[model samples]
Target: MQRILEPGQIEALASRSVPRLRLPDRSRVFAARAERLGALSRGHALQGYLELLATLAAAQHAALQSLEVTLPNESRRAAARHHGMPVIPALGEARSSAWRGVLDALRTAVAAGNYPPAVAAACERLATRSAEALDAQADRLLAVEVAVGDAAAAPLIMAALQVYWVAMAARLVADDVGVPESSGVCPVCGTLPVASIVRTGAPYAGYRYLHCALCATEWHRVRIECTQCSATTGVAYHSIEGGSAAIRAESCDSCHGYRKIFYQEHDPAVDAVADDVASIALDLLLTEAGFHRASGNPLLWQSPG
Candidate 1:
């Protein structure tokens, strides 16, 4: 099992830093993008109430950034994902449009604002039924779509949820069972981490935390080794001009894998997901260095084919 800093440990580090970094306010951009996406996604599965929740979550996150609220732990957030539960219908020996219908209802609820309590009740019932019917493949696809839709309309909210989910999962494993050798992958959801952070401060200063891509959990990994191959050889840091202080890509020559590191010291408001999306230049530079990313970001790859 790998070792990780408890949630309290991380908070202590955040509290002690002199001249703590300030985050940015991108709420306007997020709101504008979300509104445009809501319009485009009118007929899609992410319409209505779900879309509204996503938008509100994004706005709230932006506000939280401005207020410097320490975000919820990852484990608690992950639980919510499972709790909210995707509305998949049962194993349809036939393809079910139930999922689509549920999305439509959610959209309707968000846009119309006239959906009664009965309507919400009906939608919830349908969502539960669909989830039971859908296969794992369908479920995963739905999860991706839901995430993408939410991100398009509410990037900050989606990002925060992602982080919360991972943290919750990590807390479960680390506190209950113990950390695995490859904390590189999210133990709870079996997804790759977005980056490996070199955290500073007491009880675990200079420790490595593998940040989850899906749930945003940060699990402890040992320092001075490659997360991909567990190799201790030829690990290096590369960064783009001017962006070096804010973000850097940690490359492992042995495994040909690289992860981005966000220096919270330099910018407290730096969200791993939002800032990562904004720093494509750094990714380009890391890619040019022959290091491939172990994790994936949908927004970073939305270029037209």
Candidate 2:
């Protein structure tokens, strides 16, 4: 199955003249929060993450100022040698200094053999800084796109954050929503799901799962069915050595598509993007099995067809 959108077609569609989407107020807010979180997450070990987040937030806000339309090339690669590098790493000496501080704080807390409020406080402070930086960068990107008449850029950037925020929010609220017997669509976001999980332990066992792409939430999909074509025949599951039984990729011969599933009992901290990045081998295997992904990741979308 040809799951990915053809780049040339997408580019052609983007080039055609059309009215831009007017993002809703709620979407704008969600975009801001999501951008902030993304930057903060990037700087998990560096001090400048918070600043990057803030820059991204500002970019969204600025984009909203111009009728909620984003600039084209918002997703474009930077021409500079270090374009698209997260601001935290780009901060050079500042990043190193901040990392050292974080390490020292963590070390001291560990040696104390007790949770240090200061360590947590410091982390929060750094997160705030990253958020600020992201806001600024976001604003700059919006400004540049608008000035250059590239309407596509704003939406691309906003879309990236929207996906991230929705995933995070979905995860936080997954349990509240009832799990289905089988399905791949997110109950909350109504977006195509990325993975499914078979959890172990009481109350979670025997239930099949689907992970959301936008909000990063996992919900239950009915077991033994193809998420794309709803066909059960020829469905197969595979895993790598040392892989958690809770998580595996479900491949559908009928549709020639596959999605990843995660069992909560396997590893509680399994983030869709982070874990997916780490499990490229599984993806490669699925590809070899004549299956392809139905959705795209911002990081992986650049792959050649």
Best by TM-score: 1
Q: What is the lDDT of residue 99 in candidate 2?
A: 25
lDDT of 2: 0.45
- Tell me each candidate's TM-score: 0.50, 0.44
- Tens digit of per-residue lDDT, candidate 1, span 92-159: 12123332332333334443445456544544543454334333434433244433321222222233
Tell me the lDDT of model 1 at 132.
42
Candidate 2: segments with Cα more than 4 A from true spot: 1-160, 163-183, 200-205
lDDT of 2 by residue, 221-276 (tens): 45677878888798888887786565588788888888776666766545454345
Candidate 1's error at 95, in angstroms? 20
What is the clash count of model 1? 28
Name the top lDDT candidate: 1
Candidate 2: C-alpha RMSD after superposition: 16.7
